[model samples]
Structures are given as C-alpha cells and as structure tokens.
Target: MDVTSDEVEMETAPVSADELVEAMRQAADDAGFDLEPEQLEVARRLGSLAVGEASVPAHLYLWGAAGRGKTWLLDAYFQALPTERKRRVHFHSFFRALHRSIHEHRTAAAEAARATGEPGAGARAAAGAVANAVDRAVEDLLDEVDLVLFDEFHVHDPGDGTLMIRLLEALFSRDVSLITSSNYPPSGLLPDPVYHHIFEPGIAVIEANMTVVELAGDTDHRRSSAVQRRQGFSRGTWMLTGQEADDELADLGLPRPDAADAVTMAISGHEFRASAARGGVLWFTSAELLERPTSVGDYLAWAAEYDRWVLDALPAPEHLTREARARFVHLIDALCDLDVELHVIAATDRETFMTAETLGRGGFARDAFRTRSRLALLRTVG
Candidate 1:
C-alpha cells in the first residue's frame, strides 16, 4: 500500500524528546496544571524516545495516583504533536469501535459463505473473518499514526484482555509506539487471577521497553480552584424544605421532578440525572461524571446547566478499593480544576464522610490522602 505524504513525513520527521517535554510543560502551565521538576524530567525522557524510526520500546506505561495530571500531561503532549503522526483514544471508545468492526466482518463472511453454498462453513469462515478484521483494524490504527496514546488503559473484560495483548504485539511488530496511562500499575491490572497470565506478556514487554514514570507531587490540581473557593468563601446555611428546595430549583429552571422522581440536567453535552435519596441528599453516579472529558471547559459547560449541586452521597471510600480511590481523587481533582462547586446535604456528619473506614483502610498513602482530604472538604463546602 502506498503511504500518504503525511505518513511519510511522520515516518521521517525527527521529534526531539526535550522539545516535546518542554511543550508539555508549557501546555500544562497553560491549562493551569502545576508540574513538578521530576515529573517534567520523566516526560522529557519519554518524549525524547517516544518518536523516531528505530525499533523503539513497544510500550510505555505511565501509572500514578489520580489527580496527579497524568491524563492532562499526556493529552497536552498529544495535542501539541503534529496531528498527522498521532492518535489519542480512550480505551472504552476504541474497544467499542473494534467490536463493531469485528461484527461487520463476521456478517460479511457469513454472507459470503452462504452465497458460495459452502455447507457448514459459516462458523469457521466467520471466526477467520473476525481475526482478519481485528488485524486490519490494528493495521489501520498503526498505519496513519506512529504513536498511539490510550487514556484510561484498563481491562475489565476478559475478552478485551486477549484483544489488548494481540493488539500490542501487532503494534510492536509494526514499530508503532504505544503510550498508555492507567490508575493501576501494569502488573496489578486485570486482577482476576485466572486471567492474570493473559496480561503478563504485555506487562513484561512494557516494563522492559518503556520508562515507567510516576508523577509524585502534593498538589491535586483538580482541587486547586475549589481550595481557592474555600479560602475566601462564606455561604449561609439555608435549609430548603423538600417542597421549597424543589420549587426554588424549578424556578432556577432545573428540570421538574419526573414521574420516576429523577432530576435530569444536561452538562457538557451529557445528561446527568440526580435523584433525591434518603435524608434529602442528591446522588450522582460515577458513570455520569466520567461520561465525558472532565476538563475545565466541560466544567464551565456544567455550571451553565445547573446553579447548585447537591450531593447527598459523595463516592463512599468503601465503595472503592485503593486503586479506585486514587482514580476517584484524580477525577475530583479534574472537577475541582474546572471550578465545579459541590454542596452536600448528608445525614452523616462531614467528619464521618471524610474519615470513613473505607478511607482509612484503602492503601492510599497518608500524605496523599491528607492532601486529597483537604481538597475534598473544600469541594464539599463549595
């Protein structure tokens, strides 16, 4: 196949690791995300090696606690890149695309077998067709881009486990660079013991080939704005009786309560439904919060949609394990970074919510939790 001029240029253009690192720093600064010196150094090294025609490392695994700006930095790096040479995709979205491609191929193969009158050939033909479809999808993904940036690299489904290993092998063979960010270390992913070995080869490849950089720092940039809000904040405690709060919310142009009793608002092109739970609290789900990029832009969009947020229940620390807790903190940081104000009306005391047993037992280091907890308090108050 004749590669496009753009692809040729990507294949030949020399990308400086240091320059890319500097660009990332500038981008972070532009986005108001503070980067530590060591983090910048690690990014510089990765940038230096991330591009080039040599048989570079097959995979680069960037793992850290949430709210450390891993995704932001990676995105900054990706966006600053000459667009023709890179592709950035969330794992879930990519997998869904891949799944659709697989299904299409299977359907085509079954039709071909039927037209040929090949008795009992549909199953085998479809299987081969699916494999070929996956291979082609992988090829196309690599063909146009030298570097693949996968955000939120996670393996919840066993089927995806097999696909990921295969996909990485193919990309490595093609000399395409893979950069991924995840909440879990490579070794700790896909924790089901039975399927753990499926991920081992990919993990080993990443460890040997790419530099594993940890973004260690104190500030949760996501919460910075919320902290600022709390620093110079004062709000009267106004009790809105159920009817009064409802009427006030309605007057503010929020959705009228549905027959099913859900208050729905559109935020950043996504719909979020909040329902009054016990003790007059409102609840938002993780699925709702993570449906789109939780960037500053998105947060501003959300602010226009709803005047006030009432979280009857924040994500309980117990609801998440250590890895999950870190991820949530990162999300909260993103929300804070966007200046999304939160108001919680809970039956439980603030201390009880802040110091839940789940919070204590989760494997987060004390210092990290302390920093995050302070931010959480600020967000709740706002």
Candidate 2:
C-alpha cells in the first residue's frame, strides 16, 4: 500500500478485460453491493467487447436507474484501458468543448472568406467550418482512443439533442466506439413526445450498433454503507470569531484574507471569493462553493481541498417554484455525484422542512418526495 511515485507508475499497467471485470466486482464488494448474475454477465461481455479485436461499434448504450453501477462499470472499463486509448468525460463538458471548437472553426472560416473574392460564401464557409470542427474534435477524441466513455448522457434541450445526433453521426462515420451511461435508455431520453421523432434515428442507431446492458438492482453503490462511511456526515456549526476562522482556515491550508473585503479561495481549480460578510459570518452557498457545470477534475479538487464545508444556507425546496425547485434538486443531485461532504450551519433547520406533506403540498408525489428527502438527508448529513 505504501507505493512510492516510481513504484506507483510501475504498477500502473494496461488492465485486461478479466482484470477490469474483477476490479468492478471488487469495487462492488467493497461498496457493499450485491451484483446480480445478469449484471456480472454484462460486465464480462462489455469487457470482452472492449478488448476484442473487432473495431469498436458506433455506439454502446448502458442504461439503468441511478446507483445501479452503470457509471461505475464504464469508469472501471475506461480506467482499465491503456490511458492513451480512452477519454472519459461528462456529457456537458464534452458538449461545451465541442461548441467552442465549432465557434473557433466558424471564426477561422469567416476570416478566410473575408480575405478571398468569395461574396456570400461566408455562410457556406461557416457551415463547412463547423462541420470540419466537429469532425476534427471527434477525430481528436477518437485518436488513439479505442473507446470513449460518456457519463450522464441526457439531453434536456432540443439544441443539445440535435448536436448529439450530429456528433454521433460523425463519430459513427469514423467508426469510433462510444460507451454511454444514462438514467434512461436512448428511447426514453428527452421524453417530450413532440421531439421524440427528432431523437428516433439516433436511438435506432444506438440500439442497432451497441449492446444494451441493464443493472436493475436496488443497491446504490454510491450510497452503500461503506461509501457512506468514507464520505462521512456533513453536520455541525463552526462558530469562530472572524479572526479565529481566518486563522483556522490558514492553519488548515486554505487561503487567508489579510483584508476583510476581499477573500480569495479556490474551489475545483476556479478561484472565486465570497465578499467577507459584514457580520463576519463568511457564509458559503452551494452555488458559491460549487460553480454550475463543474467538471470531474473540479469535483476532485473540491473534495481534496475541503474536508468539511460550513454553509449558512441551502436552497430550500419550498422557497423555489416548481422549475426552480427541479433545478435546485438537479444541483443537489450533481453535488452527490461529486461525493463531497457538506457541513451546513444554516440559520434555519431546512432539513426538517423536507417532509412528505410539505412535498405533497409542493406538488411532488410522495415517492418522489421520499426519494428527494433521502438524497437531501445524504447531502445534509453525509
């Protein structure tokens, strides 16, 4: 266990399919998950296909409920592969990168058109530039990468769904293999009946080209007993004087403020500040602590940098309108995705306010309320 840096590097070898599956099993066991036989079989088959000689298919879809090890399986498989052969990214980050690439391509194309005698060619040039950018991004992503693993692959907007289709079409043409995990199957994605047709072709391609695996089990490995222990509870209030808190933060290896107005701290690699509170509360909101659309790297950084977080407020379920509540719920869900411990020292006990009746009154079903309550408990206490 005491692996030196050199020894650690030496120990890292390309993981075989069997090794990958075994590692998944071990991780499941460690997290107190009881894998069903079917789940195990899927893992074995996925490992085999991933390591097989055949060129990877256009797509591979693994869909199941939250905490069913869909993400875990894909992550384990990706980690097992040779580093150069894989790129694991959340769908949002990938889309943002793709969008930026498209923008750059369009800008270049515009510049080129401006320099040439081509009038009215700007639009066509821009379109071609976008296509090329998409192609190049897909190519770079697929370059040397035998498999691409995308986690939380869900389309909430029409624009995103269209972009996904185009991206997949390009990747498929190039024969780049894709493995994606989602809460719902391809057909169920973007559940609006109106836009279902738009998503149909993409879903058909996914179904035809990729093996569908479902790990239908009640146990959420992320919330398993062992994981709970590792994550620890987020509770208690650290009531220290302004100066005391500042000094303690420095002692704990966090940034200390020499002036009260400006407080500098880094969360997930992006540095931002909470204007020092006039009351010396130095309150932290989940929004302030977790910038929206955070990356896995950012999550890891936040987890390592802060063992315990003191928050003055958490967005309450009742205070938000339906859409707003859903967004906040999604945000909390994302926080759980990061697995960071949160310690809330709020003025009000928001925990007690999340009740079945309150949720019912708020227009949420009892079961939905219960699920959200459980997740909230995990966020508040875990």
- Candidate 2 lDDT at 219 equals 63
Assess candidate 2 and give its lDDT. Answer: 0.56
Q: Which candidate number would show the highest TM-score if scored against the true structure? A: 2
The candidate scoring highest on lDDT is: 1
- Model 1 score (lDDT): 0.57
- The root-mean-square deviation over C-alpha atoms between each candidate and the true structure, in angstroms, is 8.8, 7.4
What is the per-residue lDDT of model 1 for residues 1-382, given as tens digits with 9 covering 90 to 100? 1111112123344557677787888876775656687578657756766464666544577887656667767777776565467777645445656776787889989888878887878888898886787788787677657787777676745777877777776776776788888767888777667788878887776677666777777765544544333421112111223455445444534433444766666544566665632232334544444332333334334443543444433344455445544544444443343334444333344445446765554444433543344344442322
**C-alpha RMSD in Å of predicted model 2 compared with the true structure:** 7.4
Give the TM-scores of the predictions, in the order they appear.
0.62, 0.67
Q: Which residues of candidate 1, in runs, are more than 4 Å off?
A: 1-15, 32-34, 53-58, 114-120, 218-220, 223-253, 260-382
Give lDDT tens digits, candidate 2, residues 120-236. 777788888877877777776666555677777777567667777777787767655777887777788766677777787778777776777776777654345433443433222
CA lDDT scores, all candidates in order: 0.57, 0.56
